[model samples]
Target: MVFLAPKKNLFNLYFLRYKFIFLTIGLLFVYILLNGDIRSNINVRKCFSDINVQNKIEDILLSERKPRKGKTIFFHETSCNIPDTLNHVRLKARQACAIESAALTNPNLDIYVLFASPKILNNQTITPILESILSYPNVYLRNVNLWSYAADTPIYEWFKDGKLFKSKYIYSHVSDFLRYLTLWHWGGTYLDLDVVMMKTIENIPPNFAGAESIYHVAAGVLNFDWDGFGHEIADMCLRNFQTHFDGYDWGKNGPGVITRTLHEICKTKQIYLMTRSRCFNFNVFQNETFYAVPYTHWKYFFDSDYLERTLEMTKNSIAIHVWNRYSSDTPIIVGSNVAYGVIAEKFCPKVYKSSGKYF
Candidate 1:
């Protein structure tokens, strides 16, 4: 009985001495349970370390909402060359300039820049130019599946059959088809990535496009209303896209389809005559409004001497297509007095400033 009493006293004294340490451990456990992040333990952290996991998360976060048909401005990135290191779509300086300019010109409209291939975005992947454009509340960046984008539309079969991939000019042809599909699915203003908005297009006729020449209407700058005849034009263009698709002729599917459709609709060879004509439901603006500096004079954009002339020519232009096909190889030296440099500096200051030396 004496030995038992001594052992009991010893146990009681030891428990009392360490009671505060036990209490702290229990409280920490309760806190970990209360905080939901405890659920995101080692497994979650390990999963997030995978690039695909991060990409899927970003994809959902950046997904596009149902766009306002008439009020959305659409630009497409059809390239699939996402570098292994960069899972996000990286736009060139000129392309970023185009998007920012559109946002600047039409602050009320939603500007959508969709990528055809799946992209994973993170703080590291987003470049300064992309980050700058994303700062605009009206601008949205989304990764889109080309097949899903064309689904249920008349061009679905064509896209599914992989006809777009078999083209000699695959990227360009994909862009053309995607533009029509975009219009058919969600009617809106579709601009080529190379086209920079110089003025607000809010006042322009809802169903209008710029003429590339007296003979053909350009598809670079296109606006189709959400409903009524404009929608009808989009539908017809999709049908024509499928019916008259020719991978051999470069322009057959794009400019060719639009021009042919307009001729049939207006039943006039002189398509330019219908400009701003209230009698017809659709209008075509002069080439000077969009293609003021034509492809032939593409070099003028980089020439310092032509800066004043370029400004004068584009004074009345609502948008300018710098003919990326022709001028993409040409570099705009930073701090130069070239026309493109001046225009980009004023319209897309962030991208211009972020571009280190040349853009």
Candidate 2:
């Protein structure tokens, strides 16, 4: 009986051990299925990073309940191929002038320009732009060294389809630009040089955070809530850029990475996407108000006249943005008649002279 009992006891112990092993294996498989390998998936990683940043930016904004009274800072960075001479200077100057005029109309607000470190040229033009900004107490210039964080070679060169992709400098420029904002403005509006500030933006809603609510606002006409999610988004973008540095060269892949990141981060926090009414209209002028248009709607961007008509009809627009077509020298013209032409002339008279003048 004693020998038989020992054998039975051994059998029970082995059976229990096998059961436990199976249970552990089953749990592990479930975890893998549920969570997956997020880091390995570029899209997943991008989304994760974006959500992380949005939360951080929201935390910052929520902490500062009061409206920031400091000067509105307009920021920009120049890369190697961008012209620093006559044409480029004129375009940049026009943008600055438009913003400065808007600021002058509103005495309570000041506009300042922070010139990021010039990669293509020496610091010579920086002085002139600074001097020009000096005319107004609110308008000023500050230089930032973004190259410190940038990899020695462009991120695209490290990837396979780098040749097809553009905006390689976006990640690096945005990082340095935000860093300067933190140091100088702490919590202020950061306007893109290509954007034209149409109206005074003295009281941006605390929840709005200056980013376009409906469609994502272009980084160009961003309003940093200092307490908002700009920093977090910027940080996540940088990290993702480093991780999927090779994948960025795919056409639209880089921005796609950014968009995914923004959406994911915003979703996790339950931070509602900013609606068009909450922030400025992202694109299109309809019913006399700037409306948010999706990025995919680029095909509808007929020309400057079409944009101008849209602007004229828009009721409340914080700013008008001219993105994507930044590299083209000619005025963006679209449409096909006197009715459209009249509206276009109201905003941009020069469009009348373009090849598509009839349209």
Give lDDT per model, in order.
0.79, 0.40
lDDT of 1 by residue, 10-88 (tens): 9998998799789999999889875644343322222222245455423322344667879999998877542344455
Per-model TM-score versus the true fold: 0.81, 0.47
Worst 10 residues of 1 by lDDT: 41-50
User: In terms of TM-score, which candidate is strongest?
Assistant: 1
Tens digits of per-residue lDDT, candidate 2, 1-359, equal: 35455888999999999999999999999888656533234332222121221112122222333234344544554332222222122224334444454455444665544333222123344434334444555543333333322223233233233221233344443433343333233545555554444556666542223333334323444433443354444445444554544423432333433444455554432224434443232121221122233233432334444555454443365554434343225333344432223333333333223324232
TM-score of 1: 0.81
Question: After superposition on all CA atoms, what RMSD does each candidate show versus the true structure?
Answer: 19.6, 15.3
